[model samples]
Target: MNGFTGELIGTAILIVFGVGCGANSNLKGAYGKGSSWLYLCLCWGFAVAFGVYAAGQFGADGHLNPAITLGFAAFGFFPWSKVGAYLLGQFIGAFIGALIVIIQYWPHFQIAKGKDDGNVINIFATAPAIRNPLFNFLGELIATFTFTFVLLNLGDFTQGLKPLVVGFLITVVGQGLGGTTGFALNPARDLSPRLAYALLPIPNKTSADWAYAWVPIFGPIVGGILAGGLQYLLH
Candidate 1:
């Protein structure tokens, strides 16, 4: 497969597992309902690992997150020419993945709807636990900065067992820093799925919370850029 196809498929896989977990945890009548935060973090981490493996197997760099792609391109770690293709694939794939989750948890959504669960939006996107815009943005920025900086040191994270290491990184980040803002460290991961939640038909859906959307989109991008810039200067 080519880079575009690889990224699309990989991101789709990521969403399948990650958002599916969200559905399971939040939606009523699911076996995994009300799972712990650690469970959610681990599942998301493994989702990322499998996504990276799939992307690498299909001949792409496995940047399922636009922040990473743009940051690397800005610092010359990745080619500028491929940034558009990667971003397109990531966003489109994220939407597809979210749709799959909706289908998979359709019954659960209906059950929740019957009980008037009005905040199902969290199943598709991140939300601040405290609703502080500035602090929430900074939370994402600091978390993503730490994530990207460690990722830069990994070099070729898709190779060998590095994907597992990447997964571990995600888990630790979520565990340590995810409480305040749900750790939306990737714009494509947060925005595309949130958009899907907004546009798609789902029972008991709430507002897409577009008011706070900018935090995830710009925070991760800025964080990634700063991490890449620091790495570039050090090198």
Candidate 2:
């Protein structure tokens, strides 16, 4: 497996576990419905760890995130030539993963119809608890900055026990800073699945909230770049 294929499969797995957990917690009639925030965080963390492992095993760098790829490239930690392939893989994989979740939760979606259970879009993307766009953007920036900054120190996070450590970092970040905008630290993780939700036919769906989409798309990229810049300065 080359970079594109590895990234594609890895990101698909990431979305499968992460968004599957979202569907389990948010959709009605699911056994794990109304699960706690910590559960969600842990599941997402594990999702990323496993995705990284898969990507590394398949011969990619295990980014699964455009911000990581771009940030590292900007700082010369990664190659610029591969950015397009990695990004394409990440977006496509996220869309596929979201589709899988929709299919897996189809029954729950049917039962959730007209029930006011929750917005189906949340299963595929993030939304702010409060609808302040500026702060929401800032929240994502800070969170991703912290995440990427620490990740820079890891150096080849896909090796040995580093993936688990990365998972632990995600859990802590979610628990600590996720309350604001659900911590969409990766644009592919947020935007692609959101696009899927908007375009796909899922029952009990609400507005895809395209209005707030810029926060996740631009915020994490900026945050990641800043982290890489700072890392460069320090090193």
Candidate 3:
């Protein structure tokens, strides 16, 4: 009910949807991916919208992503002193979500993946559609900008239509840009699940791809700030 609680609970649900899709895809005899691209995208959008609806009044950043928080903080919407708390809360929530997901999909991990292939196991974390950092960064920047811009405009109390726009915008990003970077538009989306990947007892798991971790964390931060700055300049 408090700020941290809202963030923690909301983040867990958000990861559940995202990670649940990944686990469902690999279930034995599950056929080709149980969910489609569009389904997942809009699912993500509503996930945040609903999460915020519940937690927004509770004082949670409803941030789901560090970049948005940091972006707003850079513009003075969030407090510098509290960013750490928000990040910590988000990370903890992500860990719990990923753990729940892994438990929920234990059977599939044993069956479809045969407990091999770190790549298969990592859908719970995230992987890039393309390994190139340049394109990956570009995708994140563009996606974050689109999402953040929508948020800024819809933020005013006088305009009650922002939530729909943000939700729709999230769907758009997932449909268009999610194929790259698995669309880690949210830092919590990446880092929290990642910590789970590191600790979960899956048969085979990779290094969490630390070599490229910076891309998601910084890319969204950059994109969010750029979006906020542009909005500030324009209005």
lDDT order, best first, reads: 2, 1, 3
Q: Model 3 over residues 44-152: C-alpha lDDT tens digits?
A: 7776666565545566757767788778788776678877777777778878888998887666556554434223634665567778988888888888887787777
lDDT (Cα atoms) of all candidates against the true structure: 0.90, 0.91, 0.71
Clashes of 3: 0
Which is the leading candidate under lDDT? 2
Q: What are the RMSDs of all candidates, in order? A: 1.4, 1.1, 2.9
For model 2, residues 1-235, the per-residue Cα lDDT tens digits are 3899889989999999999999999887788989999999999999999999999998998899998899899999898999999999999999999999989888888778733785567788998999998999999999999999999999899999988898999999999999899998999999999999889877768888899999999999999999999999999
**What ranges in model 2 sit over 4 Å off?**
none
| Position 175, candidate 3: lDDT | 83
lDDT of 3 at 127: 67
Q: Which is the winner by TM-score between candidate 1 and candidate 2?
A: 2
For model 1, the run of ten residues with the poorest summed lDDT: 113-122
Error of 1 at 227 (Å): 0.3
Model 3 TM-score is 0.86
